[model samples]
Target: MKKSVKILLIVLAIIAVIAFPIIGTYNNLVSLEQKVDAAQSNIDTQLQRRSDLIPNLVSTVKGYATQEKDIFTDIANARSKLAGASNVSDQATADGELSNALSRLLVVVEKYPDLKSNENFKDLSIQLEGTENRIAIARQDYNTAVTNYNTKRRRFPSNIVSSLLGFEEKPLYKASAGAQEVPKVDFTK
Candidate 1:
């Protein structure tokens, strides 16, 4: 090959070598982003399940604890706030509110033996607890996926591509203060 032609060939090979990993990283980032989205969807579904369970649980308790109107109203308000949440931060804050409401509601149930022993309330509480556990798992998975995506996007060469393509870092799905660990159930319901 002639000198200029050989130089062009070498340059093309170098460019191709550099391009490969960038493409791979970008693809991996996209996959991670999708995983995060799926994880978020899982969490949302679980939270919705818990939301649905709450009204039934509250009504069941209401039959036994008629005077505890404030706690029920608080739960209703928290549920409304959670349903209105639009983003991770809002969701986290609203989840805290809901958890607080639930804690109070459960405390009231603890005092009412009939409410705690009710079959329907027991079943709903168990389902709600299971759903909450699923939500916690999903949030952890989402955070892990976000970490991987953010690492790729913020790294040297991938960062260049990410910046050019507007791949912003995703926020981690953080649990609320009370939600750091699953709630402990004492009296079944």
Candidate 2:
């Protein structure tokens, strides 16, 4: 073999050795980002399902307790906030608000024996509970995905490729403060 041909082959081999890792890192980041996005989408879907169930629930409760206007207004407002949320963090915040509103509504329902016994109200309540559980699972999945993506974007080799490709770190879905506390309901009005 000619010396120049051997030199050309050696240079090509070196380029391949370096290029392969960069390509792999870029691809891996893309995959992680997609996973994060899919998880967020799942959360959004569950949130929408919960929002859709609100009107039926409100109507059922209204039939039994027409005087509880304030709770209904609060729930409607919270649903609006959730519907208008633009990002994962915003959605999480709005969801917390909605959950609080729903809890208050449930407390109000306890004052009405007739509403509790109604078939439609019971069905809607069960559906809302299931949707809430799904939302919780979806949020957990989202947070997990965000954690994985952020870790990859912050690591050494992957970070270098991530920065080069403009891959930003995703934020985790954090529970709002006081989320664990039971909402207090006062009927002194």
Candidate 3:
């Protein structure tokens, strides 16, 4: 073989070795980002399902406890906030508020034995519970995806590819400030 041809082959081989991993890293980042996006969409879907169920639940509860106007109003405002949310952060905040309002409403329900026994209210409560479980699962999935992607994005070679492609760290769904505290029950109401 000619020396020039041998040298050309060596250069091409070197380029291939470097290019292959770069391409793989880029593709991997893309896949991770897509997974994150899909996970976020799942969360949104669950949130929408919960949002859709709220009005029915509220109306059913209202029929039994007409005097609990404040709790009902809080739920409505939280629903409005969630509906108006345009991004993940806003949705998370709104969702937390809705959950808090729902908790208070549930506490109110405890005072009314009739509402607890009503078939429609019971069914709506079950649905809300199911939707809450789904939302939790979706949030977990999203956080997992974000963690994986962020880990990859911060690593050496992959980080280079990630930065070059403008991939940024995604925000995790954090619990609300007051989420850990148990609701104070007022039996006098």
Best by TM-score: 2
Q: Per-residue lDDT tens digits of candidate 1, residues 98-166?
A: 887797778778787887888998998898788878878878887888888888889888899889888
Candidate 1 TM-score, C-alpha based: 0.86
Task: Give the local distance difference test score of model 2.
Answer: 0.90
Q: Could you tell me every candidate's TM-score relative to the true structure? A: 0.86, 0.96, 0.93
Deviation in Å, model 3, residue 41 alpha carbon:
0.7
Q: Lowest-lDDT window of 10 residues in candidate 3?
A: 180-189
RMSD for each of the candidates = 4.1, 1.2, 1.6
Ranking by lDDT: 3, 2, 1
lDDT of 2 by residue, 1-189 (tens): 699999999999999999999999998889999999999999989999999999999999988878879889989988998889887777778888889989999999999988899999999999999999999999899999989999988999998899888998888897666778898778987
TM-score of structure candidate 3: 0.93
lDDT against the true structure, each candidate: 0.83, 0.90, 0.91
Q: Which ten residues in a row have the lowest lDDT in candidate 1?
A: 180-189
